[model samples]
Target: MSQLERADRILDTAQDLLLRWGYRRVTIDEIAKRAGVGKGTVYLHWRTRDELFLAVGAREAVAMIEAVAAAMRADPAEIALHAYMRRFFLEAMRRPVLRALFTRDTDTLDRFLSSPARQPLQGAKLLASREYLGALADHGLLREDLRPEDLDYSLPTIAFGFFAIEPLLPKELALGLEEKADQLADVLRRTYGPARPPSPARLAAAAPEVVEIFERLAREYGAVAYGTTKGGDPEHGS
Candidate 1:
């Protein structure tokens, strides 16, 4: 393989190991072994595992930014809105990997989410996200009083809950990640423009809708879904 391909191969392997094993359990040797490269080969790409893993996350982040932008091109307001949010939530579910990193590896998810580095990416995406919402707003797609920033925060924040809390709850309690995600997006759409109070049954029905969005995101974004191969849910969501 070419040097770039070799480097990318190493990154994919390393990310998987990190997800499955956490930072502490993962090792350079394992990544090299998984990548079909020698240990020295791994170092040529990055000096430390921290650097390698962080690079993996950075690449994923760039892809997701593009993915959300792409989702905006789809048709029908609610469907397109769902698609856009699926992209965001899918990325958010990956809080363990790309979304919030140092926090998981070093015990800092909340701290990192609240950090400054998130500001610009958060702000830039908001402009397009808000603009997209403006289109939805015009179509009478949303609830009629919500702000674009809610698009910036809500569903993803709930996804943050999945990444931070799911592993903690038993499988039954975890329910459906994507289902909950879609339901939340629906709420965001209706609530975004206006706060339409959903009845309990309506809220329940939205579950699978959210799950579909989550599944779509996982398929498109790959490893962004909190990358825990096992039970590595985030702290109980605030």
Candidate 2:
């Protein structure tokens, strides 16, 4: 095996350990053993455990963003936006290390979450729905004066709350995942139209590109994760 491949293998092992075991308990010796390398070899790549952990954190972030994109792609027509969020949050919350990171990394999540203006790769995939809604207003498919930003915040805010907070709450108020997702979709229906709704055919046709972009993202995430393993700091001190 190449020297560089060995280094990444070690880092991947260390990262998985950190995520599963948390910072204090995970150790270099374990990482080395998992990587099938000597303790000295692990030291050669990262000077400290902290640096290795940070590298893992960065990897997880990239994987997450990539996963979010991919989920959009895999979603069926009716399930597009909701599927993306459900998958993103579901994938995100399952990882112990990531959940801790997301809870603590509020600023980072805010910078990326739903705000297409700031997040290009993610936003492009999401814009169609927003634009479709706006065009709905413009074309008189919906109310004329309902501002786009309000639409952006209103239903998504409810969806975000239910998706994010509802799971962690007690069973009495839990809403569960499916039920919560249904509620969010209902919020959209109510806000969009209790009476005359846009033709599903029209909205779906107008919004193809966004979902397609995300579909591409979902399909590419694993490959991207593998690629990161390739680009990471090469067998340092070699």
Candidate 2 off by > 4 Å: 1-15, 24-33, 37-76, 79-148, 151-157, 163-168, 171-175, 192-200, 215-238
Return model 2's CA RMSD, one decimal: 7.1
32-62: candidate 1 lDDT, tens digit per residue? 8888878776666565556566566655765
lDDT of 2 by residue, 1-238 (tens): 6655775697678767665665567778898888887776665555555555554554565566566655534432433334445565666566544665544434333222233222322454356456645545554445545765566767566555654563367766745545654565555555554255556565455345555543455444323233333234334533
By summed lDDT, the worst window of 10 consecutive residues in model 1 runs over 229-238
Off by over 4 Å in 1: 33-48, 59-83, 90-159, 170-174, 194-238
Q: State each model's CA lDDT, in order.
A: 0.53, 0.53
What TM-score, over all chains together, does every model reach? 0.53, 0.51
